[model samples]
Target: MAKTNYQELVFDITRLIPPGRVCSYGAIADYLALGSARMVGWALRNSFIHDGIPAHRVVNSKGELSGRAHFNPPSLMQQLLEAEGVKVENDRVVNFKEVFWHPEELGW
Candidate 1:
């Protein structure tokens, strides 16, 4: 079988995330056996154009704004996430436990 690139892996993980829920960089990286959480972030950063990565739906382990700077208009990510019914406060998700979407949790 052929190997999948980082961006494609990132997109696959992103697509798995359902609406109204979110995953973290660490979770996706750990699930894919990637190098590190930062590598996930880098994948998302560049996924903007090439892949329609739902980058906005990814947060930090504690549901923090880890990939904020990668958004097109700076705050667009937060706005998009908020529009999805995810509460945002101080650039972080208000209730992480409620919105956290880990692959194992969903049997994915």
Candidate 2:
């Protein structure tokens, strides 16, 4: 009978990611410990409703821009990342291991 604010929660974590870094859907899901990676993706897919969410900084576990299609022009996701100094090639983040950012960095 109650609605959870998982979407807001996802946004909170996503906002914590600094520029030039990225997190994985599964990583966020694991940090919240409330839903699966798919659920995290769902929240992000509908994130356009809110501004400043920085959803582009989130990628799949493999650093793939799996949610690119959700952007206005699918390439916008990669474009955003690149603008932040995070390189992406072939629909995936370049040097993923280096750009990967963990939510725990916030002491969560």
Candidate 3:
């Protein structure tokens, strides 16, 4: 598959994360098993053109919105996550383990 297709694969899976939930780039990468977590972040960073991605739902392994800078105004990432009832304090999701959703273990 081409690079774009790979990105689409990443997006396709990202779209599946239910509301009030979050997933790490590493989990998505592990589930897809085609790219690394950094690649997932890269794909999401360039995903601005697409709608419904909920890119905000993706964060670093430590539950930090490391990709926040890619969002317009940057704070938008944390805002979106807050809107979903996923609390983010200090740019890190609060109680990350509970809110975390693993695509692999979830049968994605």
Model 1: per-residue Cα lDDT over 1-108, one tens digit each: 134787678778888898889999999889888768888888788877865568899999988987888787879989999889999999899999999998777575
- Best by the TM-score measure: 2
What order do candidates take by TM-score, descending?
Answer: 2, 3, 1
Error of 1 at 19 (Å): 1.0
Give the clashing pairs for model 3.
Answer: none
**Which residue pairs collide, candidate 2?**
none
Better of 2 and 3 by lDDT: 2
lDDT of every model, 2 decimals: 0.84, 0.91, 0.89
Instruction: Give lDDT tens digits, candidate 3, residues 28-108.
Output: 998888879999999888789998898899999999999989988999999998988998899999989999998865653
Model 2 per-residue lDDT tens digits across residues 1-108: 133699888988888889999999999999898899999999998888988899999999999999999999999999999999998999999899998999887784
The TM-score of candidate 1 is 0.90
TM-score of 2: 0.94
Ranking by lDDT: 2, 3, 1
**Which candidate model has the greater lDDT, 1 or 2?**
2
